[model samples]
Structures are given as C-alpha cells and as structure tokens.
Target: MSAVGANTSPAIGQVHVLADSEKELPVPKRQRLGIAVVSELDSLKASSATKRDRKRQSRKQKQLEKLPEPCSSDDVLWKDIVSVLGGEAIDAAIEDGKDVQAPLVLQEEVELEVKILGSNGDGIAVPVDSKQPWAVVVPLTLPGERVRARIYRHARLHSFGDLVEVVEPSSSLRDMSRVQCKYFGSCGGCQYQMLSYESQLEFKREVVVKAYQNYCTAILEENMPEILATAPSPLQYGYRTKLTPHFDGPSKSVRKGSRKPTTEQPDWLQIGFNRIGTRKVLDIEECPIATSVINAQIAPMRESIIQNSHTYNKGVSLLLRDSLDTSVDESVDRLSDAFNKHICVTEPKSTVREKIGEWVFEYNAGSFFQNNNSVLPPLTDYVRNAIFPPSSTAPSTLTHLVDTYCGAGLFAIVLSPHFEKVAGIELSQDSIRYATHNAKLNHISEDKISFRAGNAGEIFAVVQDFPRDNTAVLIDPPRKGCDEFFIKQLLEFGPKTVVYVSCNVHTQARDVARIVEEGRYRLESVKGFDLFPQTAHVESVAVLRRVD
Candidate 1:
C-alpha cells in the first residue's frame, strides 16, 4: 500500500492516495499510510519497532513504492472522500473497469480550494470545475485555502499533487507571520509552521478526532470521549535535542583499504533533508526546531563532511545529539543549568543524556529516544496520572505495572517508585541490558524493578505471573500499533487498566477498536501530547479501563 500521506504530514512527499497491499500481514494499516517519508522516525518509548518489525515494514515499503495499489472498497478514507466528492464523475470516468482518462493529467496545473484537511495534514480537494468526484492530496495546505498544485501521480479515485501556489489562503488558519522557515513550502521538514502555534495544537487534536472517527467504527460513536485539548510544548522552537543532517557525497561504495582513484565529487553537496514531493536533498543551514547546541554543530559538521567528501561514497546523515553535563547530580534538577551545559555528540555509539523531570536517561545517540526533551516531563506525568490519578493514592491502588515495548526502560524506570513492582518487556536484549543498568544508575532497586526481552506477539507470556487485577500495561507501540496477535493476547491477559501511547493515532484508533471489540474494556480518556510542536505529529495517549 502506498502510504497516502507523510508520517504526520510535516514530511510530505511521494505520498499515494490509495494503498494496494492487503497481502502483507503484520504490516498494520496505518503503517501503509505514510509511505516513503524519510525514515527520520521518532523512537517514542514503550514503542514496538523491533529489528524484525522494522525490516518487514521496510520491505513492505519497497513493494508499495514499486506498485501503486488501486483503492478498494475497504479503503474507507479514500472511498468516503470519493463518494462525497466524485460520485457521478467516478461512474462517468469508469469504463471497462478503468477510467477512460484521468481527471487531471501528469504535470497538469490547477487551482483548487481545499474542501477539508486529511488526517495526515494534506488538503483534500475535489475538482469543482468538472464537478469531478476525483480527489487531490496536496501537502502544505489547509481547508478553505485555494492553492495551485501540480498533479504528479494518479491513483484509482484520487491524484497526488505537489503544492505549486496558494492563491487564496484561509483567513483564520493562514498566518504568514508565524512561518519562521524560509523554505516553508519547499522543505519537507515542516507543514504547520505557517499556522500559529495555538492553531497547530488544535489542528493536531482535530487529527486525533478524525483518526478515531475513521478507524474506530467498531466502537459505538457515543461511547468515546471528545479528544482532550492538545498539551502545548513548553518551548515551541529550539527544543529538538537531536538533528540528523545528511548529504550524498558520492555513490561509489566505501570499501575498506580501497584506493580512492576517481569518484568525482560534486562541487556542492545538498547537506540536509529531502525536498517536498521529491527525494532531492535540500541544503538547510539551521533548523528553528533544533536546540542551540545542535544548530551550532551543523556548520562544523558540514565543513568536515565537505572536507572529507572525496573519502566517502554514498549519502550519509551526520548525527548531532545534545548531551547534558551529568557529572553533577544537582545540575540535572535545574532544567536551565542542565541545558546550559550541553555537548554535541556526532557518533552513533556515543552516549546522549537527557533530563526528563527528575530522572535522567542515557541511550546510544543512534538508537530511538524521544527527540523533544521539554515536553517529556508532562508526557510522563500524564502517563503516571492516568493510572495513579492526582486525586487518588496510586501506588496503593495499583501494585504492579507492565511496560511493554519499553525501549531503554523509560517508562519502567520513571514509574518504578509508584508501583510495588515494575516489569519492562522489550524484544532487544541490548535495550533490556541498558534498562537494567539504567535502573541501577537511577538508584532503583532490582528487587522492585525488572527488565526482560520477549517477542512482541507473546510478550505477556513473560509476565503471565503478574496479578492481572493489580496490574496496568503501558504500551507505546510504533506507528503501526499492535498486531492482531498481540491485541488478542492483551485481551486474554486482561489487565485491570491499559494505557496505550502512540505516535500515529490512525493505527492507535485501529488497535483501540480491537481492544474494545468484545466489550471487555471501555476507553476512559484520549489525550494528545505535542512532543513535536512545530510539526503535524501528535503523540496520543488512550486510557482504557476494564468494564466487564
């Protein structure tokens, strides 16, 4: 299935309106949503992206890019839009089981007012002139904004387009003053930078609402709560602790001890990210969303890459992670002091330290950890309060917690004090090893806290001995969410409370629908967290309490 949108609509390019791959199992539906978006993916803890799952998703992505799957009856989002916009036109266009002519041509230019925004932040519009039901997916657009986009790829019911111009912008949502990036329309790094920060939060909340509306059809509409207001990031800009600036030096593979005879290096290398709707790398000197330490490192790093361009083959991303001075334990308590003493680490294996509230986390610079450090305190607080509410005696109420997909044991270690016992389940032994070491580093006792690596599908088998009624399971899976097998096991294991945190709400809704399918549990609350403030991405947490 060609992912019809970007991961969160901020990084939009190569997006397909319809996905064709129902053949691949384990690759969840929402995994099929953001195809070909640069893999600068966030590693939200309690995440489900094990090595095997990522490879499967990577392989599936290749297959999707090779073939565009036509929209089927079950592709509800596409079908609903087509029915709403192009009912008669679709019937007219279809002849002998295929459209006689595509509503828009390749490279055809058209100015269209966006009727509404898709869940992924693309503006969806129907051809008003032709009264055509065919839809166009345009990035960097908002509803009620008339924009000119060039049609690039056509699917069965809709066409994928590149935003060419915004002729008439929405009065309310469009505020040119808020757009800080000079490459607003062209760069794939951001989408909602044009809108006010307040608007961006609301828009992301709306995304959560739309995802549930589209994917959670199995659950009765009246039963679900309105998505809570999106929590704003403490700092909107210069909050990103990590940045990966990349460039293509030379295509010749770098082999050990190979003579560097003649791979001619290009005079200029675009040392940055992908351009909007294309794989071409765009040169970015500074990122407003990145921290001061990371921004300063870019120049020196780019200089090094350029200087050593002749020695390299293939494109490479230079990692710039901000590490705090952890030498003094007291400095970690003061956020400003900790941030003032920050170090930039370029190597993947180098240690990156982050202070989340009072707890400090240490992880490999290359591996996945939450990029936004500012909002983590609130994010973790929300997770903690969900089980042990501010009004209630939490630790006394819930004695045990099982943090599944607990990468580097962020949740387990953070929430350890509140629980009588905490078990962190992960597929990577290395992560578990890190978790074990982190517990000791944080002065958490091994008797009260534990970390183990287990297969995702059968993770509960490792924690089968935990008292179900006294336990809560904390899951923050990847964009795809939990597979059917894992969901089945979850319902069977039947913990007292289930707290699911997700980066992609579409799959979260899909997974939530399954969890509540048998009426064993009821969704109590759903809240959106603005981990990445300037972008379209929203980290959502859904709390489910057992009813039956």
Candidate 2:
C-alpha cells in the first residue's frame, strides 16, 4: 500500500500529452510576449483595427480605383443584356455568383448580334432581340455594322447608346471612302458622304421601306427599286443651287484680356449647316456640296456684309440660286433683284422649254426645277401614264387638270396639252409670276394655262365651280404634307383621279390614309424616286382613283 501511493504521487511530477489535430501548437515565450503587446494596444484604441488591417483595406481601395466608373444607374445596358439572354438565363447567371464581367462579354459575343439598321440626320436604329419589335437607335452610326455599345439613355421603351467598337464591319463600310469634306461628320449637312454611292442608294431605299412600313402600316410591295432607278447624281460634288449663310457677332470671351482693337477684330460667323445634334453654329468658310460659283461668291458676300456691319446692324443671310441658262446678264439681273428687293430669284437664266406630251414649259435657273434634272422626264412620264393610260378606248370627255402647289407650272404647263385647260395654284407670288411667264414663253394661250396665287388647301374654293367630268388633280405638297383642310377639300371635290406627290412619306402616308378613309380614294399605284442621292430623302408619287 505504501509503494502504490508513492508511484501515484510520483506521476504528478511528469506531464502526459494526448495527440489532437484541432489544437494549435504552443507558442514560444517571445511570440507570446509580442501577442500580449498587440492585444494591449488594440484594447487602448478599442474602436479601430490594427495598422496591418488598415494596410490591407488600403490595397483593396487602390485596386477598385483602377476600374472604370459604372455607367449611370438609368442606363439600358442591363436591360439589353437581360434581353439578349432570356430572363431565366440572366437570373441563373447571377445566382451562380460568377464574375459579372463575364456576362457583359458573353452578351457581346453572340454569333448573330443585333446591329444598327440605319441612320438619318436625327438618329440611328439598331435591331434588338425582336426582328422588328424594338430598335436601339444610336446617333452617328452607319448601318450594317455589329457594334459593342454602351447604352446611356432610355426613351419610351427603346434605348440609345454610344458605339464602343465595331464587332463586325459592314460590306458598305468596306466600299466607303474618306468623305470629300473634312467637316462632313460634324457639319450635319451630309450624312452619307462616307458611304459609297451604291451603298448610299441601298441605305436610302431601306429608309423609305422602313418608314412606310413602321409609320404608315402600309406594305411596300417590293424592296425599294435599284438606286439607279432613283436617278444617280450627274454631278455628285458641287451640285447645290441654293446656299444660306449666317453671321453672329464676335465671341467676346475669346478677345478677353487682349489689347487688340475691336474694330480690327474678326467676328465669329457661320455659313454652313448647324453643328451635328445641336443648333450651335460651326463657322464654315466653304461648303463642298455647293456649286463652285456659289462658293466663289461666298467670300465676297461675307466681306461685303462685314464691311457694312456698322451701316446694317442686322445680321445677314445669303442665298444663291442656280439658273439653267448661265448668261452673265441674266445672273446679274437675278442677283440684283435678290439684293435690292430681298426676293428669291427663282429663275437664274432662261432655259429652253421642257416638253411633256403635247405641252411645253420654260424655266429659269432661279426657278424650281426638280433638282434631279435627269429623272424628271421619266418621273413626269410616269405620272402621265398613271393619270392617262394609253388606250384607244379612253373616254372622249375633256380631261380637266388642276395642279396644286405648282411651282413655275411644272406639272400644269407640261400636262396642259393633254387637257382642254390646266389651272395651276401656288402660294408664292414669285412662283405664280414665273408660272405666267412660263406659259407665255411656251406660247400656250393664257386662257388655257391659268396661274393663281393662293393656298393649296383653299384652292378647291377657287376651282370648285369648274367641270368635274374626266377631271384629275396633281398635287406635289411640301415636306410638311398637305393640311387637313386641303385633304377635306379634295374629298369634297371628288375628282376622278388624284395624283399626290410628296417628299416625305411619313406625312404623305398619313394624308393618304385620311384621303382613302374619308375621300373614298383608292391607292392605285405608288412609286418612289431618289432625287437626292447619297441621302435618306426620297420623292414619292401616289395615284389615288375615286372609288365608285
């Protein structure tokens, strides 16, 4: 009993340890002392972390600072991304806790991505997920390129964006050449200068088709006819017959803190179009699209205005109209009238007569001639064919013709021979005066060709008393389309045939719908002419026959 008690007591002098993976190794005496020091310092400043922790957080902040700022909260990037990949895919991707950056890149890398479809001066349209449901319209983009973009604005249900990169270049881009003018992209005067002429035609055709389809709910029976059918420009460069230039007083901010005399200073002036996407003036000395004659005269015109600034405090605007006959005497007379009377010289020089069917008409350069001189014969022929088909069985009744919105009696004087008498109604006194002169020049009896100055909408009141049998009306309204009053008047007059000519299809379609619904006019034939090549603008002629 004494031995056993001694052994048990002896065990207290030695330590026995059991192995445990969860337990940490014991620290040395020096390490323990250092930990004790750290704990004491942390307790002294109990609210803040240690210096090591602060250093780690600083490193993280620096890393974040290197990344780009996120787009505005209202941006459409997220919406577009979600749209491209269905909502289920988007939700699943987020739940997977994968890197957010991966989704953006994945969305952009789609095999067949939506692209910018087309552009006018205002904006561009991009195909979204739907074939035609939604379009992403970005300003300043050429069509047919797949682009990675950053959407920064949202409108109604669509979105707007800035092009980041062209993921795939368009065939049109490959053929595109450097713009003829340096200021083309910024001047807002020309939108398709960068595209090849062929590409420009395609672009314009698409614009017409889309506009008619989207805005009018009318189906374009065929893709827009070939660009050649629209009439290519004979002289692509220096073709503009009219030019207007503006001047603003000197920019005082630029002259600040200068000792130069204000009288000798040059004031800021603008002679071209407003800046792209803005009304602010961009000073232009010469315009590439204007004729050389016009450009050559601009400098002197500007100088004259500058010299007379004190005498004429009012700002100045310049207009130069082209005449078909380039006789110096004629040009001088036209210019003198424009300068002295502030009248727009419609005819620059007297040109030979334009013959349509049996009718003939003369025009001056200052007067309005369809800018596409090459296409007018064909276009007018088309109109004539549409109105009076060639057949031996045609009705013998005297076909009376009324030309509303007639300028210089283009349609009226040209088609007068086919009718017993043709009447032309115009708003501009100058135009009416020229129309009268035009009739005299062509040797048409004044009684046969009557020119009246009045509003197109009120024209029916002036011509209502005339016979209506075998009667047809030809109207080429302004880009704003005909007014409701005019449409209503047309309905009441109820001519057998109505030929509606328009430069803007959207407004034209609206008017056409009204005429068809209320006037009982059936759309028989509609055709578009590409008068302004290298631009989205197109001229459309629609024939509507009264429904019996």
Candidate 3:
C-alpha cells in the first residue's frame, strides 16, 4: 500500500482538537461534517414527532441568524468565532432575513497541496493563504498531490473545485499503478481504480477508521475495540453479480459523418452507467467490474433494444443479472428475454438465483443482494462468529436471534443453526415473502424460524416474548443508517448483543456511538468487508454486547 505523503507534513496549520476527551485527536477542520436543514423544514404537517424535530431545527436556525456578522476590522478570526460557538450555534447566527450563509465566490486558479480525502473520495485542500472559511474539494485528485484548481462554489464548510492539473502527483499516482478500465475516468460505477488492489483495501480501512474517529467519541484509537483489517474480496473486478444500466429517451444516437437526418439514426439510445458527477449516461460498451456473463450480453442487448427502439417512449434501466454458476449463460438469457417482454415495465418479470455456501437464494432481478458475491461467505461467517463465539454454548443462556431489517433472510438463515429460534423482521412484504420462502427452501423448519413484515417499529414488540438476556439482534439498515426511533426501540429491546452492519461508516459510527453512549452496551469489535472493492464504500460490522 502506498503511503500518501509518507514523509511530508500537512500543508495546513496545526490541527485543532474539538472535544474534552484526551484520546480524541485533533481533526482537520475541513473534514468536520455538519447537519443542514432543507426548505422542507417549513412544512411540518407530518407526525407530531416530526413537528417537534422541525421546531428544534427552526430554533437552531434562528439562533445562528443572531450572531454578529464578520467584518475585516474585527479582531477575531471567522473560524475561531465559529469554532468557539460551535458550527450549529454559529449557523443559527445567520441574518434572520437572509438565507443561511452567503455562498462564496470562486477564486482564480491556485496551487494547493491536497491534505486529506473527504467523505466522497475527493481530495481536501485547505487554502492556507485564503481568507475564506472553506477548503477546496477536488475530485479525481489524491492526497499528497499539489494541484492547480479553479474554485467553483463554496459550500457550507468547504468550496468545490475543478482540477486543472496535478502540479505534483502523489506517490500513488506516480507509481506503476494504472486504472484497469478504459472508461475509468468517466464511469461512476467505480472509484479507487487508480490505487492498486492492496492500496484499495488499506484506503477503505482508513476510511472506516477515520469515520469512527470523526463521530464515535467513546472509542479512541489506543483503547478502541479491535477493528480487524478489512477482509479482501476473493475477486475484485468482474465480481458484481448484477448490473443495471439505463438510458434516457428520446433515445438518439448520431451516425458519424453521415449528414443523414437525426431521426434516421437510432433514436439516441445511450445506455449505461451514469457519467461521473453527472446523471448523463455514457454509452458504455463494457464494464470491467461487472460479471463476465453480464458483460457478454451488453452489446447484443443494446443492439436488440435499439432495433426495437420504437417500443420505448421513455428511458429505461435494463437489469442484467448473473446467476453465478455453470448456468450463468442460461440465466442471463432468461433475464434478457424478461427484459424484452417487460421493456417498459419497471419491475423485471424474473427472479435470479445466487448460491452462497449450501444455500441458494432466489430474489427479483433488481432487488438487494450483496453486489460482491465473492466476499459474502466470509462476511456472513464473520457476523455469525461475532454473535456466536465458540464458547457461547457454555452459558446455554442465549436462546434466539432477531434480525431487524432482514432482507430475504440472509443472516437469519445463516445464523439459525447456532440459536434455538430465529425471527426475521422487514418492512417490505415482498422481502418477508422471500425470506420465508428462503427459509423453507433451505428446509429450515417453520418452527425454528419465522418472518414478519411491515412497520419496523413493532419489530421488537413481537420478539419481546424472548428473554432479552438470551436474544441477539442483528440490524442492517440502509445507507442513510437507522433512525432514532429504531435505535430507541433496539435499546428498549435490550438484546444480549447488538450487531450493526452498515454500508455507510460515518452514519454507522453515529448510530454505534449513540448506542454506546446509552451506557447499556460496550463496543466489542468492528470489521470492514471489501464488499465493493473498487468503490469508496465499505460494509462494516460492529458488535456490541450488553453491559453485564
């Protein structure tokens, strides 16, 4: 793994530690995230709890509007003023009649050394010379690089910039590393392609660690629970089990050089992944990250869709799912046929089967299945071992497993054997339907496992019959992470152990920190899974045990 600026110091001033914890290290100001309220806050006609939230947000905004405006004659630094009062308090000081903070104007081309990577994989560079209270975020640039950038617009805490040139490339960029895909720069499907496979693993691990440092106050690096090194996927590229490439209509493709009327050429049917930083779909011929079978069908499918282009009035996303076996070809054929039949239908007319270990899971083509199938075995196995250690049977106290947000019973079925009984709860009826079917398909007795659907708020209510001291709860929420309501419910349920699996580490850190802060559980361990190897995303699992 390449060390970004291994020998060099950060170009910015001294890092300022934020809180009272001795182990809490000073963080770069630019990387500090803040909450922003939307215009939707004006409409608070939803639930009473939502109205209370809106009122609190309104009060916070009003407070920010009350602070004195910065002036050149003032003795205090703008950052110092904001930092002293805290970001939210300062935001509340914004002028009441005006919007939040005034948008910052762009500065001319300037050379800045990239200090660190931001949440979205952008290189963060603080302009030590500028008077503005913002850092420049440049995409397609790496930390430790000196780059000339043109500032676009200043956001709440940082300015967005366009990279002009890498004045001094990072060691990683200067190395023999090369992005494998031809469309690496334009395709939004994958990032971190520029880094070697080993470097990518390290980068992802660092991302998770940094997230915890930023949000989780209870755990410090020295005394923190073990964060096991990321388990690398067996296959990096061509590991994705499914691909959904789409095109917007009026499908128009221009025939080169021929002055033929625009309508004569295929109705500009551009189908593929969205271009990086934009919703525009690039006509991708091949995607190196997608499975081999999915790649094989792209060209023919594009041709077939264009040939019958008249049938499609609106742009549509096509699902190409691989069954991941010797029958992959047949499976692709079936999906392609389904696409042809349901060309306009949003839902595909088929379900695809994926086998992990001895179990085969069949779900709809577009539904959620772990994208990186190669790493799922280890990922699930790790969760099982974390929840049920080898010595777990010694107590004979733990009796059941409760899976919240259980999608199609992946963990419930996998962990069922170790428990007396397992219950899977999901908000989606379709997911519950499939989860139940999956259990039956795997021949798990109905008495041993059951599935429930609708209103996750009641998830714990049904599982309350089981002794809290004998139950383990598995929560795998969506990317935005769990809501406070659910977290409160989980704490109330008071399971013996709570396992949280998240795709977004920042939010995971936030949720996990809150759970720990409740003084009911201690974080046991955290591990990252390279589920999406080439992307800036990591699936992390955090295990917390109830305080004895």
Candidate 4:
C-alpha cells in the first residue's frame, strides 16, 4: 500500500471508497430518485399558492360584510318634512379604511340650506336640493325659518334630517307678551301661540287642503266651500271648557326604608297639557289656555289630594269642568235658556256653557267641546239642515234622526224639534247621563229623544228595525275615525242620509272610500271647521246621500 493511501485508509471498522473501471461505486438512494426531489419542490410551491388564494378570498369576504343592508321601498324616509317642493340629499361619512371610491360612485352627498316651509306638530319641510333633488323632512323645526340640516335617513332619492340650527327667523315669531304663559314651549298647550291668529288660520287651511290633495287624493273644486272661511273662536284665550291635571306625588315617607321623601313639600303634580311634540304630561300648575275658573281650582285640588294622599291615590288624574251657561251674554237667548234650563237641575255644573243652534249644553271643566264656539252654531246648523232639511212640503213630517257618538246630546237635543223622533248613542256613561239631562233641561220631550250607552259601531244593530227611508244617521267619530264595522253597518242599515263629522281628514277619506265602494251612498257636500286655531287640527263634516 502507498503511504498516502495507507494514511487515508479507514480506521478499524470503517470502509474505504475507491473508483475502478470494472466495479462501479454504489449510488446513494437520494441521488438515484431525481424525479422525487423535483416533485417535492413543486408540491411545496402548490401548497403555498393555495394558502395565498384562501387568504385573498377571506379578505374580500370581510370587505363585503361591511356594506349596509338595503332599505325597504315603502319606508317613510322623509315623512318628517312638510314641504310641497321636494329636493333634498343625504349627508353621510365614509368609514375609516373603507374604499370611498365605491360609495362615491354609487351615492351622492349634499349639504342643504333650507327654510322651513311648513309644520304640523310632526315635522317641518324644506325645499329640495337642486343638486340632489330629493324630498327632505326635518324634525323639531317650525315653519318660516331658515335652517341647516344634514340628512341621516335616505330613501330611493329623498332624505330627511333634524333641524341643526335656525339661521333666519320668521316674521310671525311671538313677542314675549303674545306667548301669554311662561311655559309656552314646555307645556305644549298651544302650538300657534307664536303665530298671529290670522297666520294660524291660513296655516290650518293650507294643512287641510294639503292633506286632502296630497294624502287623500281628493279633487277639491275651486267652487267648493273653503274650510278656513268659517269663523274662528270669539275668545281665543280662555276658551277651553274642560281641563285635566295629573299628579306626580308629594314628599312624604309612607313606610320605613322606602324610597319616599322625608320632608313635607307642596305637591308638584297638577293638571296641564302634554309636553310639546310628546305624549308625556308636563307638570303644570296653571295653563293659560284653560278658563280662569279651571286654573283657580288647580292648586286647591292639588293640595286636597296631597293632604289626603292615603285616601287619594298618588297617580290619580284630576279634572275640572265648567258648568255655567254663558250663552245669555252673547244675546243668544233661545240657546242660552235651553242650556240654563237643562243644566240648572243637574248635578253641580262647571263654568262654561255653549249654545249650538237652539240647544244649550252645560259641560264639566274637563269635557270636550268645539273650540271654535263662534262657528259652532253655523257648523251644527249646516249639518242639521243638510241632513234634516226642513221639510218644505210638510214641516211636521220631517225625518227621524239618530246622533251617534253624541257626547252631551248636543246634536240630539238641538235637532229634536226638526225630527219626529231622535236617539243619541254614546260609549261614555257620563256622556249618556248628560245627554238625558240636557233633553230634560231644554223642556223637550225625553220620550221623543232616547239615549243609549253602547258602541257607536253597533248603533245600527240597536236601531235596525227603524224605518230606513225616513231615517238619517249623524256620526261624530273620534280622531281615529270610525272602524270598518261601523261603516259596514251604516251601509247595511241603508239610512236615507249620513252626516259624518271627523277631526282627521285621512281617516275621513278612508271612511268615504269605503262608503263609495259599497255603492250605497254618494258624496253630497263637504265642509271644514277651524275649531283649533294656530294648529293643524280641523273639524270636517261630509254629507252622503243614499242612491235611489
């Protein structure tokens, strides 16, 4: 062996490698499998590519999840605004890290400078934006003022917002004295105290016309009687006949460890109007809208309740009604005497007495009465004459009349002389009792005029046997309007005529639609009474005659 070869030789048990021409060196297993190495590299690349694809897909899905859901088509987006011109845009901001380009391409953002065109205790409307062209309604805004508003809710093309700030003021803003009460805005007793009386009438008239034309799809003829043409209340101030006060509680510890006050304090609860634009009752000691007598007794009543908290529940609502007959002061002697006679013998009466046509009604302080007392006679007369037109041929053969929802029997007692027989139906037991007492006070034959206590919707069932041809029905439904059952029964009973009195035009229109659809009655005459000044509330009467 050579010296270099011997030094390189493997020690002890190690093997030595040598190349020879005849014998080939053993090949390693890894070197012999070249395709396996290439396949393993390709497999690692494919797995990495799949993981990258999955991560990209997950990122896209997360972006898609951030989008807002679409709104319903019938959603009332701009109902808060009360404007005729409809052009407004939405104001919105893009989220951080969001692709602003996507929203910018699909949605438009606009800043609107608007003037409050009108208000109906619900919302204010501003002219639409020329750039955006969508109707917008703003809440908590008054008419005749300029405001900057940002739209929050969007619909098809329209948008709505809340009043941001008042830039310009209206000419009709109430002077300090004109507001009359300190709590004008807080108490919400009157919405139009800030507006002049004439302006109030104009606004109300516009509201009526707008509601009829816009919501009801009514075609009002120019020759039709104007709703605002009627006279307003003779006394705008102190016109309310009834007032109701709520009590919160007094400071007193009724029981040990209870959350009751420990010191004696004046009862903070009393009769008052609801908070402005809300249904909550405001704790008011006095209300300027109520009559003096009603205001005078409020503190005493509160004191009485507070002193006898154990006897009187803390949560009870107190009411004061006016029962005196003031009709004689107006030189309406016939009506005055009728009311005095009817109310004189009844239980203790309140302070206000109103005369409608030839009938006088003495109501409690908290009872409901037509606010526009001056126009009440004419309004009632119009209804009576339209329904029971004095028989030109024979006055004695006049048709019999039924007054449904006849609170205090004002219609029944006043129209008793014109009808051969009259009946009044009311749900309130107190109202029925008052109606009966009213007929007696007028010295009218109670036998000729009967009172029934039940639902007005079921009045026809009670009087279905009455002669249909010679009978007329007078309905003065609540603000919500008569139910479908009442309309159906009225049609089925088929009275000669129906005089519908309503405080809401939308419900009135719905009821009229039902009547016309039944094909039993035709619309004859429609009239409106501005009983509530400075507010959108209006009283309307529609006469429908049976088709022959």
TM-score of each: 0.80, 0.64, 0.73, 0.64
Model 3 per-residue lDDT tens digits across residues 415-501? 888988899999888889889988987889999999977475566787767888899999998877887888888888899998999
lDDT of 1: 0.78
Deviation in Å, model 4, residue 109 alpha carbon? 18
Runs of candidate 4 exceeding 4 Å displacement: 1-119, 126-144, 148-165, 172-177, 218-230, 249-271, 278-283, 302-314, 325-375, 388-398, 427-430, 453-458, 464-466
Of the two candidates 1 and 4, the one with more favorable TM-score, higher being better, is 1
Cα miss at 501, model 4 (Å)?
1.1
lDDT of 3 at 173: 52
Model 3 spans > 4 angstroms off:
1-108, 127-133, 172-177, 218-223, 251-267, 324-347, 390-396
Better of 1 and 2 by TM-score: 1
Using lDDT, rank the candidates from best to worst: 1, 3, 4, 2
TM-score of 3: 0.73
Model 4 lDDT per residue over 490-531, tens place: 888888888888877656756776786645677776666777
Which 10-residue span in candidate 4 carries the lowest summed lDDT?
69-78
Task: Give Cα distance to truth, residue 385, candidate 2, Å.
Answer: 2.5
Q: Tell me the deviation in Å of residue 135 in model 4.
A: 6.9
- Residue 546 deviation, candidate 3, in Å? 0.6
- Which one wins on TM-score? 1
All models: lDDT?
Answer: 0.78, 0.59, 0.71, 0.59
